[model samples]
Target: MAPATQPLLRAALLLLLLLLATSHQATGAVVATELRCQCLKTVSRIDFQDIQSLKVTPPGPHCTKTEVIATLKNGQEVCLDPEAPLVRRIIQKILNNAKSS
Candidate 1:
């Protein structure tokens, strides 16, 4: 109703809309995976004794193949093929360990 305050109200509304748009863009953003598949290549077998730890990431949107990453005693990481017999046994061992604990 007041002409003098109309400009101020318009500016405040504009600022609110701008802030909302920026915040939404910052929070509701899709983070694209840098590496679609973490393992570009995999080894059929690796010495079981040398492995310090193992991590398995199941197939998902980022990668179509299951990934098995092994950390060696020397702090080195290697990818092992899931289809490999040795790798399967190692995975089974790890799963058994988790179940027992």
Candidate 2:
């Protein structure tokens, strides 16, 4: 190994270790409930006891603008801010989506 590149190699290795350490905190394993997006939907039968806050619209057989704050299956409370369209869209899409089991 060239002595001139030793420092660069050490820095690269350190960066890799740092990334791995932080990623290790959150296991890649996703709970089955988490996979089921319907849990976020108001019409879904899935339980929402874990949700901290919710603002659901009147049930009329269709989804409404009023958002609902709920905890994900992973025991994470997700706040669906009305102002953030990105957040609202992503959550709604996921909650209403179905994946082959």
Candidate 3:
């Protein structure tokens, strides 16, 4: 190994390490944000006939509010307000059906 080139080689290695660390932190921040929430807005009501399916996600460490996502027959999804009276009644009905089964 030539002494004259040793410093340049060390500098290149340090730069590479710094780049890697910065990218790792950026990627981690993206992943953390992705896990935080899935719904930003909620509607108080939806046409019952248009709904094809429903997904209910209870509050957890990632979010503090209960999320109700409905997939319409036309393939569009919307978030329903869990606190709405109609939504609450529907949820209770579904739970009762599940329990009876």
**Candidate maximizing TM-score:** 1
Candidates ranked, most accurate by lDDT first: 1, 3, 2
Candidates 1 and 2 compared: the better one by lDDT is: 1
* TM, every model: 0.63, 0.28, 0.59
Clashes of 2: 1
Q: Rank the candidates by TM-score, best first.
A: 1, 3, 2
Evaluated at residue 93, the lDDT of candidate 1 is 88
| Prediction 1 TM-score vs. true | 0.63
Q: Which ten contiguous residues of candidate 3 have the minimum total lDDT?
A: 24-33
How far residue 81's Cα lies from its native spot in candidate 3, in Å, is 0.4
Candidate 3, residue 53: Cα displacement in angstroms equals 1.0
Model 2: runs farther than 4 Å from truth?
24-101
Which stretches in model 3 have alpha-carbon errors above 4 Å?
A: 1-33, 99-101
Q: Count clashing residue pairs per candidate.
A: 0, 1, 0
Top candidate, metric lDDT = 1
lDDT per residue (tens digit) for residues 5-47 in model 1 = 9999999999897555433111122222245766656788788
